[model samples]
Target: MVVNTGLYAFNVTCAHRQITPTVNSIYGDATPPNTPADFEIKVASPSFTRRFFRPQVSFYCDQHSPFKPLPLAQAYALLEWGMNWCIATHDHTRLLVHAAVLVKNNQAIIFPAAPGSGKSTLTAYLAMSGWNLYSDEMAIIDLESGFVSPLYRPVCLKNNSIDLVKQWFPESVFTSTWKDTHKGDVAHLKASSWKQYIQCKPTEIVAVIFPKFVANSDLKIYSLDQLQAFETLSKNAFNYGVLGNLGFKMVDKIIKRAALFEIEFGELCDVQAFLSEDIIR
Candidate 1:
């Protein structure tokens, strides 16, 4: 299948038959059949025996398998993650930051955080609540313009957040949860339709937020200086080291242009209020 995911077209072949429905549901008819794709990928059984016994699927990009085989139930998730891996690893035209990107009023803010930091939860909330979700896992910034582009992909919800989001937004579409993955229980939330995603243009990033979720605590915001923001963003980027001098210039441009902050919050509403009342203005 040639799936046009806004940012890139993927030519995906699935040996696991069930993934096709999920792909069609999320992507719709974004691309024509026989269209060219940027990345050629597959989710298939590792061996003939594995296809029948215990049933595991492995992700392949071209001929190379970057990750080990996973349970058959996780084939869709594997395909999504593998697509992200392909872009982050191969595409050097943009600066790929490990962040959740949300845009409002033609201005963008990127939340760069580590695993288990509630980034995806926050992204899922904001995206469903009217913010244009550029990406749940990557902030793809153009090297020259320093503007962020949207990736038509689902927000990955892990562990308890999956149920939390499902309960919070009953209208949202979510994939079946894959139990006991390396990231704990995992599900993907289709926060927006392809129509909405394709309407989003590459927008200038106005802020860099490093968010940490602390249970039952009040929202606390800390302003970060350029030096601090640069250091942290550099660490969060996938191609920072590979881009070298070009990377330095792009990071410098964003740091100089964007306001920087680190936010610790117990409630998603508080974060939303801060961004709307303070940052967006």
Candidate 2:
């Protein structure tokens, strides 16, 4: 089967048609029944029944192994993530930052942080509340328009956050947990709808936030100057260096248009309240 992720299309062939029900349900239609793309994926067998590994790749799984079983839902999450990496790493002419994006009132806010920085957790919380989730792992900025385009893919939720979000919004949809992976227990939240994917819009970014989850830390929002924001954003970007001078122009436009900040918090509620009162207002 093949899938098109809006930005790029992929062709995936799995040994078993019933390997991942969730993946099939969401991406089954994406299989290139007509068009063509350079990106493609081929799954040898059902992850539950096969022992597999690729060259230079360290992870492998088998049916009888003690490793925790990865549910079908989680399989789709893994697939999407791998595809994103492929696109970002190979397409080096655009600015691709590891960030989560949420839009309000036609304005977008980007949160760029390293792993374990509570970026995804906060994104999930705000998305479930009211914000439009653009993406959870990537913020794709258009060089010409100076606007951020939405990538409506799954939101990767990790470890304790999986259960925390479940309790917070019991009605929210989540993929099955893929236990014992590199990032501990992992799952994916389908935060944005399919309609958003089809009707994507370019949004002007109004704010850039770098979030850090500190236990017992008071909720603090500090202003970030344009120079600092530019440096930080460039470092977090996946393709800034690849774009060369064009990348510099894109980054300059973003910083000039957006207000930047660094937020430190331990509670999602406090962060949400601040965003509602300060940023959105």
* The best candidate in terms of TM-score: 1
Question: What lDDT tens digits, residue by residue, belong to model 2 across residues 226-263?
Answer: 99999999998898878989888888888898889999
What is residue 116's positional error in candidate 2, in angstroms? 0.3
Q: Which stretches of candidate 2 lie over 4 Å from their true place?
A: 16-18, 25-35, 45-77
Kindly list the per-residue Cα lDDT of model 1 for residues 41-109, writing each as its tens digit.
999999999999999999999999999999999898889889999999999988999999999999999
RMSD of 2: 5.3
Q: How many clashing residue pairs are found in candidate 1?
A: 0
TM-score: model 2 vs. ground truth: 0.84
Q: In candidate 2, which residue pairs get closer than 3 Å at backbone N, Cα or C atoms, i.e. clash?
A: 2-30, 2-31
